[model samples]
Target: MKRDKDALTLTRRIGVFGGTFDPIHIGHLVAAQNAMHAAALDQVLFVVANQPWQKEGTREVTDPKLRLLVVSQVLRTIPGLEPSDIEIQRGGLSYSIDTLNELRASHPNDELFLVVGADAASQMPTWERAEELSTLARLVIVNRYGYPTISSILDFDQPILAEMPWLDISSTDLRERVRDHRPLQFLLPETAIEAIELYQLYRNRENG
Candidate 1:
């Protein structure tokens, strides 16, 4: 019974977790660790977006190169997690399909999984090359509060819902705290905190 239960817990071999990671925080770390343990994934690559289409021309986004550096520092303390700069190197609107295609070519033998939140999964139908995304990776939607569980919308294939821990942390809030000069001793990793201080990130809300 124990062996069977353990076997059932194992999930994917490799998971692709792409995001802005503007300020990688404890909440994001918790989500990734939760996904890895619950799904039994061997490893997860945190891919920081270079030119997030949604952010460009509408919102102020942090420098992609700096974001990548911060993500690497944070992931160093956490095992089974690695940072990928594929999109940063590509230098354009980061598309899910393009990243997945690259991963498939690099690791043809490994079973690939794409990590997503309920919101991103819901917007799949409208994503760039949306039709081809499902073919490249198996989607694993992370559990986030307030958002109802969504399967498939607009004829898109349903993503597998993953059970995760609740963490009330957001980059928006973190930035606000920084702008207000609030303490962030426990909300983020020391490396992330150090990087933010070293580069003076989020000091001025107008620029962050």
Candidate 2:
């Protein structure tokens, strides 16, 4: 895809994949790659949430820096995957509409694509400024295993729902496996798993 070059050259087709990435895993990578290909995006930015408003009672993420590190490590192998600190730098409850708006402002001529899971797409209407968000960017909802039907989401008007390779993996399951001292060899990329082990995340640690 050719980027639009004006006074300042700007990549016109960019995909924004926002997630908590408590521990970046293969599932996240697969979805992003699939969305990029399906949407013909020039680049995909992985926006790690600084504060996920949706996961309110889900225990404040282990550590944002650690999560960012894991994301960086996982994205290292992917050519077009770019790790962005936009949400983290903003420092507040991360909202999709706000992030998309910020990105749109940064690249005035570019077409923004917001990548999301089918489950998220199903409940998008309830999110803050859902209508405005829909207008700001084209939503690319990746169909995950066991996701609800797309028709249920009234907010997504003529949204792009792409069928990607299904990988039954999730951060929640990964965290549980870690907490239980179970093996997580194949759940995530080797680098991501190594980073988790190095940081001793999820494992009960003594602190003074």
Candidate 3:
């Protein structure tokens, strides 16, 4: 029997770039864009964490809705980058395996690429259902300039490496800068900065 060409489902390559995104910064955006290009991803979804289990007791996390809002606003004008509230909607400790499971269920035919930083890649073994990540999606590790690709062994296939110049930016630093009312010029997208200002987010640790 001959199958119709129109009946064939084209497999799309989707990159899942999950993060706390307390306030999406330029580093995060650059990593995702470079990862997408390096991995040949069709699109990248910025999955905002509802509650990052690892950071639960360490410090305060910005509200998930507010974080998602920042992500959406900044990604609005960027092509092939999207904001996903999957973890936020699920309402629990955000786990990569859980998110990948949900994405797999919804997108069975598509190829999934999980993007992570070099630092995070070294700790994959400690993640929940860590061994199952290989079965769920291919890993794409983003390494900053001058940083060597990690040699840690894992069960998954060799990760695709995306290299970019190092940017000295962190969510913690951004939050503190906002708290101190310091200028954030060139650190984050204007849209994200605007959203942060509009929501009066991170004005203080107590309310952040």
User: What Cα-based lDDT does every candidate model obtain?
Assistant: 0.81, 0.82, 0.90
Ranking by lDDT: 3, 2, 1
C-alpha displacement of 127 in model 1, angstroms? 0.7
- Candidate 1 residues lying further than 4 Å off, grouped into runs, are 1-12, 153-158, 205-208
- Could you give candidate 3's per-residue lDDT for residues 1-92 as a string of tens digits? 12235648778899999999988999999999999989999999999999999887888888899899889999999999999999999998
Candidate 1 per-residue C-alpha lDDT over 49-94 given as tens digits, one digit per residue, 9 for 90 to 100: 9988877786588899999999999998678999999999888899
The candidates, ranked best first by TM-score, are 3, 2, 1
Candidate 3: where are CA atoms >4 Å away? 1-7, 151-153, 206-208
TM-score of each: 0.87, 0.89, 0.94
Off by over 4 Å in 2: 3-11, 145-148, 151-157, 205-208
Clashes of each: 1, 0, 0
| lDDT at residue 118 of model 1 (Cα atoms) | 72
Q: What is the overall TM-score of model 2 with all chains considered together?
A: 0.89
Higher-scoring candidate on lDDT, 2 or 3 = 3
How close is each model in CA RMSD to the real structure? 4.7, 3.0, 3.0
